[model samples]
Target: MKIAFYGSSLLSSYWNGAATYYRGILKQLAARGHEICFYEPDAFDRQQHRDIDPPDWARVVVYDATPEALTKVMDEAADADVVVKASGVGVFDAELLDGVMRRAAPHALRIFWDVDAAATLDEMRADPDHPVRAALPGLDMVLTYGGGDPVVDAYCGMGARRCIPVYNALDPDSHLPVAPDPRFACDLAFLGNRLPDREARVEEYFLKAAALLPDRSFLIGGNGWESKAMPANVRHRGHVYTAEHNAFNCTPLAVLNVARDSMAQIGFSPATRVFEAAGAAACLITDAWEGIEMFLTPDKEVLVARDGQDVADHLSTLTADRARTIGEAARARVLREHSYALRGAQVDAILRDAAAARAADLPEMERA
Candidate 1:
């Protein structure tokens, strides 16, 4: 299948947190012989801060963030076997959604792949005339990076033909245990672009904990936090490049995964960093959210914190041996059950089954 994927930058993780999610899943889809061409708009200074060169698995088309450029890509994408307009392209998202629904060939599978399903759903609900709400009936399927049953039922209820959660997973080939680098060495490290919905959680779960453990070292690696004041013990390394993520994950005694407000409230929505941290065998501590047991075993593979106090409590008792034990267990669990190979195959089956179902329906309609 020739897949045309319109998304945020695949070559940069600058302000775009979904970069690895795209690379991980798409790479496996390509491994299964599905040709992929990623269309990304040049915006948000992402091109200026490329984390990776164009990868072999997907041919990336970098276009201007203009209406004309969007139109050109939409025309080219219409011919693909699969036309996907992933959410959060950071430019012309509504138009892209409309394009995927209206421009794709009737035979082509049209997917609105929502990387941030929880938030997207929230927006769509508040604004009834959102492009996604309008496009749901016409789309072939809605695939989310995460947002289990709640998201599926919501989209289906909103007239989507099909909705599936393709949870984020590790790319073992691309991410694995690397020797710890000193630059990232800390007791706890977090790597996420600071955003409105997530900033308070970061402060509560990460920064507050940093203050509690005044002796422990803390590192923050992401954009938009340079100006944000932090505790004395915390160090901010604004925008750690994707290349250094392994080191960033490995060097920390433990890594924390903070979900955006919607994701935490929605539950079953694991951030991509959770798997990335697990891939590098970093002991994981995540904010309390529903359905984590579906992915990793709590207390054994991961630590769940309800608040800043819980975060501090966990770190205070966490010895080096315990951290290592938890990290190893988390890594093993994810590698066995949560790798992108599995995610890709899951998506492949979903696409195939949907196509087959459509074919079956076609003959019946013709007979009618």
Candidate 2:
């Protein structure tokens, strides 16, 4: 299958949070003998700080976010077996959605892949004129990054033909246990962008934890957090590149997973960071969210923290051997069931079934 994706940057994680998800899924798909072409806009200085080169399996096209580029992308997508317009492209998203919708072949499986399903759906509900709402009924399927049953149900309610949650998973090839980098060595570390919806939770779970454990070292990595007043015990490194993720995860005694308010409420939505950290054999302390048990066993594979106090308590009591045991367990679980190879197979099956169903319906419609 030839799949064309119009998503955020796959070569840069600068401000593109979906970079890991896009890269992992497409790389696996390409490995499985599918042709993949990724189209990303040259926005946000992403081209200036290209983190990783595109692998041989897929073609990466970076273009100006202009009408001419849209025309070219549309022409390329029209011939694909599947065309995906993902959320949070950060430039002319609505125009890209419209272009894909207009150019996709009748048999093509057009997908609205929502990386931030909770936030997207929330906005759609509040505003009837949202572009996604307009594009929903026309697309063949709606796929999500991690939102579970609730996200699927919401999309169906909003008039999607079919909706599926393709949650984030591990990619052993990219994320593996490596020797810790001395620069990021810390007791607890967190890596996430400073988005409005997640700032409060980061404050509650991470910053407060740092204050409580004044003697322990903590590190923060991500963009847009330069001016925030962090605790003295915590060190902030702005915009850690994708290449440094494994090192960042491996350096910490424990990595923190703080969910955004929307993601926490929607449940079952684990961001790509969770899989990346666990794959690097880092003991994880995540804020309580729904459906986490399905991915990792709490108190065994991963630790659950209710608030800053819980994080502090976990840090205060955890022995080095115990932390290593938990990290190992989590890594084993992800490698067994949550690799991108497995996820690629799942998506392949879904697209095949969707194509078959559309074919079956075409005959009946022709007779009518």
Candidate 3:
């Protein structure tokens, strides 16, 4: 099958959390003999700070965010077997959704893959006239990064024909345990772009934890956090590159997963960092969220924290051997069940099922 995907930058992880997920899934899909083409807008300064070049497996087409450029992208996608317009494209998202829904060939299966399903659904439910909500009935399928059952049920209730969760997974080949570097070594570490939606949780879970454990070292990574005044024990490394993730994860005694507000409310939605940290054999500590057990068992495969005090308690008492045990268990679980290969296979099955269902509908509709 020929697939055309439109989303945020695939070459840059610079403030783009979906970059790793996209690269992993698409690479596996291409390896399975599906032709893949990615369309990304040249905004977001992603082009300027690219972490990787276009992969040999797929063509990455960069275009402007102007109307003409969007029309051209839609035209390019018209002939594909499956055309995907991912959520959080960060460039005229509503317009792109509308254009793809209107312009893709009827035979082409159109998908609205929500990388941030919780936030997208929240907006759609709050506003009756949202473009994505309006386009729900026309979409062939809806895929999400998180928000398990609640998201699927909500989209289906809102007139979507089909909705599926494509939760984030680990790419073991790229995110496995590495030699810990002293530069990144810390008692606790949290790596994420400082976004408005997630800043509060970062403060509560990461910064506050640091403050409480002033005796222990903490590392903060990613962009937009250079100016934030954190605890004396917390060292900020603004914009850690994608190349250094494995080392960073391995170096930390325990890495923290801070759920963004919407994701926390929706539950079951683990961010990309969760898998990455686990894959690198980093003991994981996370804020309380619903359905976390679906991914990792609390206090066994991972640790749960309700507040800074919980984090401080965990860090203060967890022995290095115990931390290593938890990290190893988490890594085993991810390698067994959450690899990109599993997700690629799921994508293949979902597309085939959708196409088959659509074909089955044609005969019945013709008779009617």
Candidate 4:
């Protein structure tokens, strides 16, 4: 199947979380012999700042979202078997959504794949100016990256024809265990951008854990955290690249997972890091979240840390043998069931079903 994706940034993940999600899914889909054309706006500055280029597997078409450029690309989108409008394209995404719907051929399937479903829904409910509102019903299907049942039910209730959660998956080939570097090796590590909503949780869980283990080395890697004060034992290495993630994961005794407010509130939504860490056979200590058991079995695969004390307790007590055991179980589970190939297969089935149902609804011209 030929698929066209309209997402935030196909080539850059600097400040774009959604880009990582797109890369994981699209690469897997490409591996399955599906032809993919990714459409991203030419956000030159953002691209330069991030310094990432599109992968070899995808044919990336960069265009201006200006009226003239959009007018030209509309027909190309119409020719695709499936045209997906992903969340967070930055500017005028709602306009892009409208243009795609208006231009798509009658047989083409239109999907609204929400990378940030919880935040999108929250904004939609609170504000009248939410752009996706009018386009929701026209969408043939709605797919989300993170939200659990509540998100799917809410979209369906709001007149969506169908809603599915295609959560994050690991690319085992790209994210497996590797030799650890002494510089990166630490007693505990956390890697995530410093977002306002997650900062408090970081303090409560990460900082508190560091405080508890003053003698133990803790490493933090991510952007937007350059100026944040840290204890002597806590080392901050800003923004580890995607290529370096495996090494980073392998070095950590236990990797901590922190969810943003929206994800925490929505529940059951695992971030890409969770899958990446687990795939790399890194012991995971995640903030206590509802529905976590559905993804990674607690006690067996992951450790749940509720607060500062819980985090400290885990760090101070969980032995290396236990950590390795947990990491191994998590890795086994992900390799067996949660690889990106598995996710691509699931998405392929969903698209096929949607197309079949649409065809069934239409009457033959000869009969008419």
Candidate 5:
């Protein structure tokens, strides 16, 4: 099958958080013998800070962030077997959604793959005039990065024909254990760009934890956080690229996962970093969110924290051997049940079934 995916940057993880999810899923789809053409905009200096070159698995089209370029790409993608318009393209998102649905072939499966379903749903709910809300009924399926049952229910309630949660998973090859690097060694580390929705939680969960343990080292990575005030113990390494993720995960005694406000409140939406850190066998400390148990066994495979105090307590008492034990256990669990190969197969089956159903619904003469 030829899948044309219009999403955030696939060649860069600069300011784009969805890059990992796109690469993991689309690369796996390509590995399953599907042709994938990823369309991403040249915006936010992502092109200038690319972490990867054009990959062999998928064809990447880096188009300009202009109406003309968008129209051209839309026309170019009309022949794909499946058309996907993902959330948070950072450029022409609504137009891309409208264009995909408008340009897709009658039999092609049109998917609105929401990388940030919780936030997107919040937008739609708050603004009835949101473009995605208007496009819901036309989409063949709504796929999410996470947000389990709640996302599915919300999308269906909002008039989606079908909604599925294609949660994040491990790409073992892309993110596996690596030798610890001194540059990333710390008591606890976090790597996420600063954003309005997530900044407060980062403060509450990460910065406050650093403050609580004054003598411990805490590493902060990702862009747009240089100017943000932080505890004296926190070290800001702006925008660690994907290639260094393994070291970033492996070297830390425990890596913290703090979901944005919406995701924390909505629950069940795990960030892509969760799987990456776990895949690299990092001890993960995630903010308390519902449905985490569905992914990782809390207290054994992961450490769940309700506030800064819990994080501080976990780190204060954590032994090197204990952290290693938890990390290894987490890796073993994800390796057993959450690899991208498994996720890709799941996605392939879903797309194929949807395609088959579409064919079955056609008229006898049209089927030919």
Candidate 6:
């Protein structure tokens, strides 16, 4: 099957969370003999700040997103078996969606892939006049990276024909544990960008824990955090690239996860780092979330922290042997159920089913 995707920067992940998810899922899909054409507008200085290049496996078509270029691709997109319009293109999402819908054949499946389903749904509900709301019913399928149940229900209730949650998955080969560098090795580490809504949780879980362990070293990575104040023992490394993630994960005694406000509110929405850290066999200390146990068995596979005290206690008490055991168990679970290959296979099946359904519904003259 041939699939076309219009999303943020397909080949760039710098300061972009959705790009990482796309790269992992699409790369795995390509490896499984599916053809994918990623249509990304040459905007946002992505070329200057690219973190990951398009792998040899997939075809990436970069367009200017100008009127002429968009018109040229409209016909091509209409011919694809599936065309996906993911949220957060940030450049020409509205224009691209309009053009694709205008030119698409009745049988071409249109998907709205929402990486930030909670935020999008909240925005739409608050203001029905939002541009994307009008496009929802036109989509054949609504897929989300997170917001396990609420997101799907909201979209379906709003008139989407089908809604599915395709959660983030770990790429075992890319994220497995590796030799930790001394510079990166730390007693604890947290990697995520600073967003206003998530700052309080970060303080309660990560900063407070680091403060409690003044003698132990801690590292914080990700962009938008360079100006944030940190404790003396806490090291801030701004924006570690995808390639450096495995090393960072392997080196940490335990990696902390702090979900954004939207994800925390929606529940059951695990970030990419959770799967990546687990895949690298790094002990995970995550903030208490409502549906975390559904994804990772809390006490058995992961350590749940409700506040600074809980985080500090987890760090102070767990023996190195016990920590390693927990990490190994988490890694095993992720490999068994949350690998990108598994996600790719699931998506492949969905696409096949959607295509078959479209074919069956077509009139006799259009069936050819």
lDDT of 6 by residue, 67-164 (tens): 78877766678777788888888776777777787677777888889898888899889988766688887888888997877888999988789999
Q: Give candidate 3 misplaced runs (Cα > 4 Å).
A: 362-368
Tell me the TM-score of each prediction against the true structure: 0.96, 0.96, 0.96, 0.93, 0.98, 0.94
lDDT against the true structure, each candidate: 0.90, 0.90, 0.89, 0.84, 0.92, 0.84
Tell me, what's the RMSD of every candidate? 2.0, 2.0, 2.1, 2.3, 1.0, 1.8
* lDDT tens digits by residue: candidate 1, 179-236: 9999998999988888999999999999999999999999998888989999999999
Model 4 scores a C-alpha lDDT of: 0.84
Q: Please name the candidate that would achieve the greatest lDDT relative to the true structure.
A: 5
213-271: candidate 4 lDDT, tens digit per residue: 89888999888778998888999998777778889998878999998888898897899
The collision pairs in model 2 are 222-239
Reference-based lDDT, residue 210, model 4: 92
Candidate 5 lDDT (Cα, 0 to 1): 0.92
Evaluated with TM-score, which candidate comes out highest? 5
Query: lDDT per residue, candidate 2, 1-368, as tens digits?
Result: 78999998989988888888888888888877889999999988999888888778889999888888878887888888889999999888998999887887776778999999999999999999999999888999899998888999999999898889998999998998999899998999999999899999999999999999999999999888899999999999998888889999988889999998999998999989999988998899999999999999999999999999999999999888989999999999999999998999998889778878877777655423
**Per-residue lDDT of model 3, residues 85-194, tens digit only:** 99889888988888876777666788999999889888988999998999988888899897888999999999998899988999988899989899898999899998
- Displacement of residue 234 (Cα, Å) in model 4 is 2.0
Which candidate would rank higher by lDDT, 1 or 5? 5
For candidate 5, lDDT tens digit of each residue in 280-324?
999999999999998899989999999999999999999999999
**Pairs in clash, predicted candidate 6:** 222-239
